[model samples]
Target: MSVVGCGYLGVTHAAGMAELGHRVIGVDVDAAKIATLAGGRSPFFEPGLDELIARHLANGRLRFTTSYEEAATADVHFICVGTPQLGDGTAADMRYLDAVVETLAPYLVKECLVVGKSTVPAGTAARITSMLRVLAPAGESISVAWNPEFLCEGKAVSDTLHPDRLVLGVPDEQAEKVLREVYAPIIDAGVPVVVADLPTAEVIKTAANSFTATKISFINAIAEFCEASGADVTVVSDALGYDARIGRQFLNSGLGFGGGCLPKDIRAFQARAHELGVGQSLAFLAEVDAVNLRCRERVVEYLRKQCGGAFTGRRIAVLGAAFKGGTDDVRDSPALYVANLISQQEGEVAVYDPQAIENARRAFPNLVYERGVLEAANGADAVAVLTDWPEFGTVDPDVLGEVVRSRNIVDARHALDPARWLRAGWNYIAPGRPALQPALVGTV
Candidate 1:
C-alpha cells in the first residue's frame, strides 16, 4: 500500500497504516519533505507523528520518496492530497487532487484501487473514474474509491490509529473487498465500517463538518444577542447544553471555528450547493462565516476600548496563535487574525503560543513574537487570551498580574479564570459575561 502527498493528512495516514503492519510507501512532490520523512522526522508539528515515523522507519515498514514510479509496485494507493480553498475564497481548488490522479494514472500497470482520503465534491469520484479509465494502461483494472478521513489536527495520530468509523465509498463489491482488506486491522478491532456508494461517502464528510460549524456559529450568534440583552451567554449556553438534544461540544461561545477544515469546508460546500443550483440550502453558512469573523472584530474592539478609545499606544499581549490548541497550523487562525488587526491599528502587540509562534511569525512577520506567555504579557496595558491553549487557562493570574503595568484582561477565548484574575485586583472581561472588575485603588 502507498500514501501519496505527505502533508499533514498524508503523513499521518502513512504512519498509521505502517503501524497497522502494512508495508507503506509515502510519496510527495516536495523533495525536502521527502528527505525529512526519509530521515525519520516530520516536516510539520504534530504531537505523536515524528515518533511514529521514526519507529516505522527503523522497523523497515515506512519510507518516503518524491517520485510516483517508486510507488507503482503497491496495488493499493491512498490519495491524501489537500483540497485548499481557491483564490476566490469560495470554492475548493482541485488542482492538487487532479495532479495526483493524473500523475499516478499511467503507472497503474496492474490492478489497483485508487482510494481518495482527501475531502472533495460529491461527484468527484465519477470524474476520477473516467480519468483513470482513460489514462491507465490497465484501463478498467484501476478502481476508484473515496475514503474521506476525519482526523482532528491535535489528536491526529490517535484519531487515525483508532478512528470512530471507517467510511468506504466503493463502486462495486471488488472495490469494497480491497478496502476492507486494507483496513482489516482496524475492522478486526471493532471500528464500524460505513459502506456506501461514491457520492454518499463524499457528501458525508462535508455534511459532518458543516453541522459542527453550525453549532459553533449558533452559540456565537447567540453570544451577540446576549451582549444586547445584558444576558450572560455562558450561563445560557450551559443551560441549553444540559438538554440532550443540544449537547455542549462546539458550544463554546467564543472565537468560532477555523483551522484547515471547518472554514474552507463550509465555504466549499456552499460553492458546491450553488453549482448544483440550490444555493439557498446552505445560505446560513455565509452567516456562520460572518459571526466567526465578528468574534475577531470583537476582540480588536475590546482591546481598543481598554486603550481608552485609542489603540495607538496600547501595549497589548495576545496569547495563542494557532486556530486552536494542539496544532501549529495558523491557516485562517482567529488568534493570529486578531493580532494582525491590532497591529494594523498601530497598537503595540506581543504574541505568544507554545507551538505556533514560528508559524504565526511566518504568516505575519511584523507582529512581535514572544518566547513565553510572560514575555508577551510583560509591561502590557491589557492582556487578551485569544486562543484557548490549556496553558493559557492554567497560568497563574497572580504571577501574570505582577509583570503587567495594568490589571486589565479580556478573555476573548474565555480561557482564563475570571475569579482568579478578579481576586488578584485585575479587571477581568470576557464575551457574553458581565465584567468582573477588580475593586478601585482607594475603595479597599
Candidate 2:
C-alpha cells in the first residue's frame, strides 16, 4: 500500500496500515519531511503517532521516500494530500490532489485502486477518475475510490485503527471489493461500512464538518443570548444535553472552532454549494463562520476590560495556543489570534502551552513565550485561559494568584471553575456568565 503526502493525515494513516500487517510506503515531495518520517519521527505533534511510526519503522513494515516512483508497485494507493482553502476565495485549492493524480498516473503499470482519503468537494472523485483514464498507462485497469478519513488530531491513531464506521465511495463492485480487502481488518472488527457512489462519499466529510461547525456556532449564539438575559450558558448547555436529540458534543461555548479542518472545511463547503447552484440550502453556514470569528473578538473584549479598560502598558498571560487541546497544530488558533490582538494593542503578552509553544512561536513570533504556566503569568496584570487544555483547568489558582500583579482572570473557554478562582482572591469572568467577586480572605 502507498500513502501520498507525509503530513498529519498521511503519517498516521501510513503508520496505522503498517501496524495492521501491511507493508506501507509513505511518499512526500519534501525531502526533509520524508527524512523525518524515515527516521521514525513524526514531523508534527500528534498523540501516539511518533511511537506508532517508530514501531512500524523498526519492524521494516513502514518506510518513506520523496520519490513517487516507489509507489508504483503497490496494489492500493491512498491519496491523503490536503485540500487547504484557496487564499483568494472560500473554495478549496485542489492543486495537491491534482499533483498526486498527475504525478502517479504514469506509474500505474498494473491493476490498482487509487483511493482518495482527503476531504474534498463532491464530484472531485469523478474529475480525478476522468484524469486517471486519460493519464495512466494502464488506463482500463486503474480504478478510483473515495474513502474519506474521519480523524481527530489527538485521537488519530485510535480513530484510524478503530473507526466507528467506514465509508467507501466506488464506481463499481471491483473498486468496492478492492477497498473492502484493504480495510478487511477494520471491517472484520464489526465496523459498519457505508457503500455509496463517488459524490456521496466526497460530500459526507464536508457535510459532517459543516454540521459540527453549525452546532458549535449555534451554542455560541445561544451563549450570546444567555449573556443578555443574565443566564448561565454552561447550565443551559447542561440542560440542553439532557435532551437525547441534543447530546453534548461541540456544545461548549468558548473561543469557537479553528484548526486545519473545521474553519476551512465549512468555507469550502459553502463555496462548493454556491458553485453547484444550491447555495441557499447552506447559506446559514456563512453566519456560522461569522459567529465563530466573533467569539475571538468577544474574548479580547473581555480581556481588555480585565486589563482595566485598556491593553496599553498591561502584562497579559495567555494559556494555551493550539486551536484546541491534545495536539500542537496552531493553524488559525484562537488563542494566538487573541494573544496577537492584545500584543497589537501594546500589551506585553506572554503565551504558554503544554506542547504548542514552538509552533505558536513560529506562527506568532512577536508574542512573548514562556517555559511554564507560572512563568507566563509572572507579574501579569491579568490572565486569560483561551484554550481548553486540562492543565489550565487543574492549575492551583492560589499559586497563580501569587505571581500576578492583579488577580483578574477570564475563562474564555469556560474551562475553569469560577468558584475556584473567586475563592482564591481573584475576580473571575467568562462569556455569557455574570462576573463573580473574590471570596473574603480566610473564608471558604
Candidate 3:
C-alpha cells in the first residue's frame, strides 16, 4: 500500500499500514518532509509516530520517497493529501488532492483501488473517480474509493489503531472486495466497518466534522447565555450529557473550536451545500461559524475588562498557541487569534507555548515570542491562559503574581483554579463563570 502526501495524516497512515504488515511507501512532493521521514523522523509532533516510524524502518517495511511512480505501482494507494479551506474561507481547495490523482493516473496497471482518506466535500470522490478513469491507462477498470479520516490530531495513532467505525465508499463490488482485503487486519481486530457508495462516504466525513463543530458551537453559545444569567455552563452541559440523545463528546464549552479539521470541514460542507442549491438548508452552520468566531472576540473582551480599561498600553502575556494542546498545528488557532487581537490594539503581548512556538512565530512574526511561561508573564499587566496544556496547571500563580504589574488573571480555557489565584491575592477571571472581584483598597 502507498500513502501520498506525507503530512500528519500521510505519515500516520504509512506507519499504521506498515505495522499491519503491508510494505508501505510514503510519497510526498516536499523534499524536506521526504528527507525527514526517510531518516525515520516524524515531521510533526504526534505521540508514538516517531517510534512507530523507527520500528517500521527497522523491519524494512516502510520507506519514504518523492517519486509518484513508486507510489502509483502499489496495489492499493491511499490519497491522504490535505484539502485546506479555500482563500475565501468557504470552499475546499482540492488542488493537492487533484494533483495527487493526476500524478498517479498514468502508472495504473491493473484493477487498482485508489482510496481517498482526506476530508473533502460530499461528491468529491465521484468527481475524482471520473477524472482517474479518464487519465489512467486502465481507465475502464481503475477504481476509486472514499475512506475519510476521522482521527483527531492528538489521538491520531490510537484512533487509527482502534477506530470507532470505518466507512468505505466503493463504486463497484470488486472495489469493495479489494478494500475489504486491504483493511482485513483491522476488521479481524474487531473495528466496526461500513461499506457504502462513494458519495455517502464523502458525506460521512464532512457531516461528522460539521456535527462535531456544531456541538461545540452549541455549547459555546449556551456558555455565553450562562455567563449572562448567572448559570454554570459546566453544570448545564453535564445535565444535558446525561441524556443518551445528547452524548457528551464535543459539548465542552471553552475557547471555540479551531484546528485543521473542525473549522475547515464545516465551512467546506456549508460551501458544498450552497453549490448544490441547498443553501437555505445549511444556514444554521453560518450561525455555528459566527458562534465559533465570536468566542475568540469574547476572550479579548474579557481580558480588556479584567485590565480595567483599554488595551492600548498594557503588557499582556498569552499562554498556548496550538489550536488545542498536544500538537504543533497552528492552523486557525484561537490562542493566536487572542494574542493577535491584543497585539493589534497596540498592547505589548508576549506569547509562549510548549510545542507550537515556531509555527506561531511564522504566523505572527510581529508579536513578541517568549521562551517560557515566566518570561511571557514577566512585568505584564494580565496573564491569559489560552490553550489548556497540562503543564499550565503546574505554573505557580504566586510567582506569576509577583512579576505582573497587575495581579489580574484571565483563564480563558477555565484551566486554572479560580480560588487558587484569589488565595494568592490576585484577581481571577474566566468565561462562563463569575470573575473573582478585586479586593477593596486598604481592606485586609
Candidate 4:
C-alpha cells in the first residue's frame, strides 16, 4: 500500500498500515520530511508516533520516498494531501489533490483503487473519478473511492486504529466489496461502517466538521448572552446537555473553535452551499463564525478589567499556543490570537507551551518566549491560561502565586482549579463560569 503526502495524515496512515503487517511506502514532495521519516523520527509532536514509525522501519515494512511512481505501483493508493481552504475562505484549493491524480494516472497498468482520505468539497470524488478516467493509461482499470478520515490530530494513531465509524463511497458493489476488504481490520472491529454513493461520502466529511464547528460556536454565542446577563454558561451548558439529543461532547463554552479543521470546513461548506443556491439553509453558520470570533474579544475585555481597564505597563503572561493541546500545529490558534492582542498592549507579554513554543515563535515573533512556567508567570500582573495542556493541572498554584506580582489569573480554557488558585490568594476568572474572585470565594 502507498500513502502520499507524509505530514500528519500521511505518516500516520503509513505507520498504521505497516502496524497491520502490510508493506507500506510513504511518499511526499518535501525532501526534508521524507528524510525525517526515513530517519525514524516524526517531524511533528504526536504521542506514540516515533515509536510506531521506528518499529515499522526496523521491520522494513515501511519506506519513505519523493517519487509518485513508487507509490502508484502499490496494490492500493491513499491520497492524504491537504485541501487547505482557498483565499476566499469558501472553497478548498484542490491543486495538491489534482496534482496527485495527474501524477499517478500514467503509472497504472492493472486495476487499482485510489482512495481519497482528504476532506474535500462535495462532489469531489466523482470529479476526481472523471479526471482519473481521462488521465489513466489506455485500457488500464482505475477506480476512485472516497474514504474520508476522521482522525483527530493528537490521538491520530488510535483514532485510525479504532475509528468511531468508517464511511466508504464506492461506485458499485464490486468497489464496495474491495473497500470492505481493504478496511477488514476496522470493519471486523465492529466500527460502524457505512457504504454510500460518491457525493454522499464527500458531503459526510465536510458536513461533520461543519456541525462540530457550529456546535462549538453555538455555546460560545450563549457565552456572549451569559456575559450580558448574570448567568453562568457552564451551568447552562450542563443543563442543555441533559437532553439525549444534545450529548455533552463538544459543548465547550470557552474561547471557541480554532484549528486546522473546524474553521476552514465551515467556511468551505458555506461557500459550497452558496454555489448550490442553498445559502439560506447555512446562514446560521455565519452567526457561528461571528460568535466564535467574539469569544476572543471577550477574553481581551476580561483581561482589561483585571488590569484596571489598562495594560499599559502591567506585565501579562500567556500559557499555551497550539489551537488545542497535544499537537504543535499553530494554524488559526486561539492562544496565538489572544497572545498577539495582549502583546500589542504596552505591557510585556511572555508566552510558554511545552510543545508548541517553536511553532508559536514562528507565527508570533513579537511576543516574548519564556523557557519555563515560572519565567512566563514571573512578575506578571495577570496570567492567562489559553490552551488546556494536561500538565497545567499538575502545576502548583501556590508556587505560581509567588512568582506573579499580582495573583490575577484568567483561566480562558477553564482548565485550572479555581479553588486552589483562590486558596493561594490569586483571583481566578474563567469563561462560561461565574468569576472565582478571590475576595468573594473563601480561600479554603
Instruction: Give one digit per residue, the lDDT tens place, for model 1 in 1-444.
Output: 999999889999999999999999999989998998999999888999999999999999999998899898898999999999999768999999999989988898999899999999889999999999999898888899999999999999999989999999999999999889888989999999999999999999999999999999899888777776667788898899999999988899887788999999999999999999999999999998898888888767777767777778889999989998988999999988888888888988999999988889999999999999899999999998988889889989889989998888889888877777788887787777743422211111
Candidate 4: C-alpha lDDT: 0.85
Error of 1 at 271 (Å): 0.7
Pairs with steric clashes in candidate 2 = none
Q: Rank the candidates by lDDT, best first.
A: 2, 1, 3, 4
lDDT per residue for candidate 2 within 1-444, as digits (tens), equals: 999988889999999999889999999999999888888899998889999999989999999998888788999999999999999999999999999999999989899999999999999999998999999999988889999999999899999999989999999999999888888999999999999999999998999999999999999998777776666788889899999998988889988999999999999998998999999999999999999999999888878877778999999999999998999999999999999999999999999999999999899999999999999999999999988889898999999999999998988888888887878988787877742422211111
| Residue lDDT tens for model 4, 312-364 | 98888988888998999888999889888877877678999999999999998
Candidate scoring better on TM-score of 1 and 2: 2
Off by over 4 Å in 3: 435-444
Ranking by TM-score: 2, 1, 3, 4
Superposed by TM-score, candidate 2 places the C-alpha of residue 97 at a distance from the truth, in angstroms, of 1.1
lDDT of 1: 0.89
For each candidate, C-alpha RMSD in Å?
A: 3.1, 3.3, 3.0, 2.9
Clash count list over all predictions:
0, 0, 0, 0
TM-score of every candidate relative to the true structure: 0.96, 0.97, 0.96, 0.95
lDDT (0 to 1) per candidate: 0.89, 0.90, 0.86, 0.85
Candidate 2: count of backbone clashes, pairs at least 3 residues apart or interchain: 0
Show where candidate 1 strays beyond 4 Å.
Answer: 435-444
